[model samples]
Target: MELEFAQQFVRPILDKISSTPSSSELIIQDFAVIMIVASIMALISYKLKQPMIMAFIIAGMIIGPNTPPFSLITHVEILHVFAEIGIILLLFVIGMEFPIEKLKNVGKKATFIAVAEASGTFMAGFAVTQAMGFTFFDSLFVSLAISVTSTVIIMKVLEELGMIKDEATYLIVGIAVIEDIIIISLLAVLQSVASTGDLTINEVGMSIILVIAFIVGVIVLGSKIVPRCVDLVGKTNHSELLIIAVLGVAFGLSFIAFKLDISVATGAFFAGVLVAESKMRIATKIIATPIRDMFGALFFISVGALMDIKQLPLFIIPAVILIIVSFSAKFITVWAASRAQRLGKTTSLKTGIGLSSSGGELALVAAKGGADVGATSSFVLPMVGAMTIISTFISPYLIKYGWKLASRLESKGTGSSDTK
Candidate 1:
């Protein structure tokens, strides 16, 4: 009786925290575990010519919340903050890399391509969801979930391959980015509409107007005005001041966007792009580099640490279904778009595979939509994390095989010409 009483009294309390460590000490342990594992795996992935994102994801799966011998770093809020910082710097870096005039060169073809991919993926994901016996809304959510290609990893691969200046590459980037803009804009409206289950055309119109106004307003005002402000801050010429200056710009824009109910990342990206057009662009990167890396590491670490292996069983089918549909959707749309643009077969095939991968940010946006509609919970968010790793791992291999097919086509044409 005494043993039973003690077990009943103390076990629940211990189990709550032990079951899922909310204790600060446990969190610190989580951080240490994440950093060490992430670093080691990153080195391995780098040596293997793969994306570090893949390394991070695999590490996360190994050490996630539901897994046995849970990762040591689970309890730390520090990693969370670091991950957030990583995202900020990442969005800014994306903006910095996109040259404004260069975007003009991709205009019409890029728009058509983006629309085609977004539409195709939506259909495919939705159909698979229905065939798999999920509700229409569920199917829609999951389809949109995996539909878009990841911009960050794709850009890196393209740059490493020395194809950023290639017209086909630009087409992919432009279309993806624009589709991202539309998806996010819809997400903002969806959050409101989902909660109320009420639609007034006037109210919907106003929301659409606000979103458009915000994007246009940022480009016009932010591009011209924000850079000047950063320049003033940078003129101080103190290393510390420059660091503070860049942080201030990122945070200030992010905060403003938040207050206006826009994505902080979109704000950060626009701010960075504007800053890039200015003299202080180099200084901004120099100031932000070390910070970005530290946070970037933490971001991946948190990603690895946050995986809930417990949820894997539930997600197993949906996750696999989501990825397969997403691949088909992106491939057909991009190939058709390439053909429309009169691209050679080589460029068209290359563009299709180059874009088969998905982006983290798009999933972030759609998952938020799922939460807003009560269609998903915190659990669904990490599935996006899983899909990201899987797609990234396979994309490079696909590209490698694609190149060989292209080479064969070219060789056959050469042989035929000689016979003629």
Candidate 2:
């Protein structure tokens, strides 16, 4: 009887200790592990003067399911929630940085350059893919995939390089905003075409119209209501309450957008714009920055986790070809557009190099959507993911050095002419 009692008492404790963890517990442990690995890699990246994004990605790959020892985290799906949060917060921050006044100032010039560059890239990408003997639909998907720039990568790179104040930066950002809308619309069309075997112009147009109306409604209505709420919340003088309120606005708007079949990032951005218009903007930024950075790290790390380097060998040729063609096409097209806008040759060239990279959240999202609809081949997602990894490493370096290289070449040509 005594031994039986001891066994019964110990068995429950042992079971509690060794039992399979709940999904929620596993997710927390995984996130903790990810943070630890990310910190070390981030330190290394910083010492190497590399972008923190590269570090976070490398960290993700190390702990990803496809990597050695197969994912330290047991429940990846749960972790994806945090990753999505990261994306939402990142977009919110980007939106906060962009206010209505700034957009108004950059409006016409940005629109013209954005249209020119995006169209040029689309045409070039289409031609290149067709030449490679891809099906027309495949070609269309690939072209659209490469045409949109990664606003996240570009904005981060520009901010790191302290080029945000440059005239070219405004245009680059404006172009990205335009591309976001265009890509979303294209994805809608692609989905319809894939599902029904015919393009439904009416449906696509309606979606775009709805998205625009939502944005306008948020800006017009949110500007009036949100600031007043914020002011009342501010009077409470509770920092935590203030942070909560800001996030509520951010995620709440994003949720509505998702429900309406619009891009959540777009919604979050407009929400940020609304918040930015208020006196509480700076305080809101201060409160939200740390949360944003933490989530943003997860977002980039998630990007890395999605990558399977082993699959790269299978699609290596196509991936490499797409990277080269995409980069070259984007550069030439953007350079031409900037020149048409009367930017200096050097500035235009730098802008071209700045916008040359592909593969970002948008590209990955488009590739995934295409694959899901069977509009693209099975190889599309892997190829795009590989291209994004390659381009992520290349873009920052190009943005950092392109201007110097251009100046050096111009000086050499001038010297040669003077000698003559």
Candidate 3:
């Protein structure tokens, strides 16, 4: 009945739109409506004790093409491209926000910790996928998808809570960088195999080497070249010109990576990191901030829009089990890593919690990549969405507990000294 009705009703409208070239203006109209709604919802959400990002997502879900009442949004090819632009800008800002000196100070220990925690988690997740009868490629995507955490959401939550400059924040930031590097590297390999088809699993090593080489190339060239370009553009004293330059570097590099089967976010991130050490980076980030916020909100909305709600409940049991397993897995590993690095017990615990909560971007990347490779079904989406929801709710409490533990430990140490 649904199929017959869809063919008669929905299919005709879709066919009419496709057959009509003059419907181009309708695309712009749809974009405007979604953006306006997203902005208002974000602002209202702030007044309600929630982050603006959450509101943007909920707004998207409500007005999405799948919904009934708000039939405003249309699924368009242009929206997808714009959404891609949003993600690139978002990642570029993430790179700009990274402190190079802090990373250097944390050094090898943080590197080891990030690698160990991520690797162990991935292995565990991969094992689960295999036992559930998944193929090698599917297991690979599932492992990578489930294991990596969202750095953006966690850091934002920490900052909103005034925990940004604390010990826990430091550990979380450092570990997230580690995880991002690992997951991105793996993605580069996955993309190469998927695109080439005949590339086979054995060629994974070469692809990884190429990815590493590209990263090193970005570091060497981006630092020297990107900042100078920004500086030159700034001297023109034209704000539009400056915006154009930043967007050029971000999008140009992203396009280059896309042509090579590399992810746009990966390219944008490196583009950010390369210029991180530059003096003009602050100015660049300031100019790019509004642009990032505007389009980045769209990216999140696209995520919510893409969610397959019908399968959500079916994926619930597996999602719960995976979230529990993955969260537990990362918690101990990161907690231990932070402690070994002398972040202390409380900070370590909070850092672990911060790293565990993820949503939106990285999971979407993994699931998209999985489906692209024919490694998984649409089920990955619901599983990821559910995990994201649970983590979002749980992280703050874990952070609160971590702070309490730190205080109690500090008090005990002080009392012992007094007794002495």
Candidate 4:
């Protein structure tokens, strides 16, 4: 029903772009449309106190080929390239912020929590999707998508609520870092599996070995080399040159990863890690942030653009079910893990709520990977996009109310102890 409406609505717009003589003009017009629409949506999102990333996505859905009315984007292929760059930069910045020292300091408790929560959520997601009658590969992709929380969203909400300095914040961030690492590694392995189109133990084992080797080789060698090169660039006192040099390394490593059939996200992340070891980490991050933001928006916009709104009604029920199951599983696993670490009940509850949001860049990346491989169901990407937007929308409220709930529970416990 929606498809018929979209087809009729999109025909004239497609014809107009097709008739346009100059390719460059079409590109310019597309950029203008994207920026103007995205800015407007972002402003509305701001007014509504929603995540800006969600705004960018909604903007894409509005202007993209999948929706009704003005389907403004003509050159989706170009946008896709930009989106890939966005993912690279997004992961790179995340990697830069996570230095080896910080990971080492994340502690056993945080490590345990991260692993436990990720494993539990992944299992739960798989089971739920399988029960929903999804294929094995679709279930695998969906499970992977929901296993990790959005570190960016969590931190942003924490800062907004003035809880960035809270004790639980540390553990939450630590667990997020570990989850990022694990997810990226899984992406690399998944890429390998996709490339070979074989699920045999030999192939799987080889893929894991290759991923480990690539990571160890880059870290062990790049740490010694990237820092000294960065220091030298810093001494030049040329910001432009510093930026170019860092991007060169990022793209350079990413290219190598691509050639090796690994996910470029893995390479870009480790590249940032290597750069972080340098004295110029702060300067590089400052230089790289705007670039990351721009490309990151493009990446998310592309994700939204790929969403088939016409098919959304078909997947809406599954998306809602997955959201509820995934969020509950994550919250329970995180809370239990925190409690096991001897974190107080209030802190544990806060940590659990803080990490409960199930969608982010990584989830979208995983969905995209599944789509690219053609190994998952057609509904996976759009379904994940829907889930992401909904979860991001509700996460802040959950955190805010979760604080009051935790406080009440603590009061009840105190009263019971007093009575005792």
Name the top TM-score candidate.
4
Could you tell me how far off, in angstroms, the CA of residue 375 lies in candidate 2 after the best superposition? Answer: 6.5
Q: Tell me the tens digit of each residue's lDDT in model 1 across 1-420.
A: 988987999788878767765567676776677777778898999999888777776676566665677544445456556666666777676677654555456588787888888878878877887887776455556667677677777777667666678655766777877776656565555554555555689777776786678767877877787777777877887778867776777777767766665556666666676777667888778768777776666666566566687777887777877887788778888888868777777677767877887646556446645654576556666777777777777776666566456556657773121221
For all candidates in order, the CA lDDT equals 0.69, 0.75, 0.72, 0.88
Runs in model 1 deviating more than 4 A are 1-30, 74-80, 130-141, 155-167, 183-187, 191-204, 359-375, 414-420
Among all candidates shown, the one with the greatest lDDT: 4
lDDT for each residue of candidate 4 in 234-345, tens digit (9 for 90 to 100)? 9999999999999999999999998888899999999999999999999999989999998899888988888889998899999999999988999999989988887777
Query: Which portions of model 2 show Cα errors greater than 4 Å?
Result: 1-13, 130-145, 150-198, 365-379, 409-420
TM-score ranking, high to low: 4, 3, 2, 1
Q: Looking at model 1, which ten-residue stretch has the lowest summed lDDT?
A: 411-420
Please state the error at residue 276 of candidate 3 in Å.
2.5
* Every model's TM-score: 0.80, 0.83, 0.84, 0.92
Error of 4 at 383 (Å): 0.8
RMSD of 1: 7.3
| 10 residues in a row with least lDDT, candidate 2 | 411-420
TM-score of 3: 0.84
lDDT of 4 at 397: 81
| Residue 394, candidate 4: C-alpha displacement in angstroms | 0.6
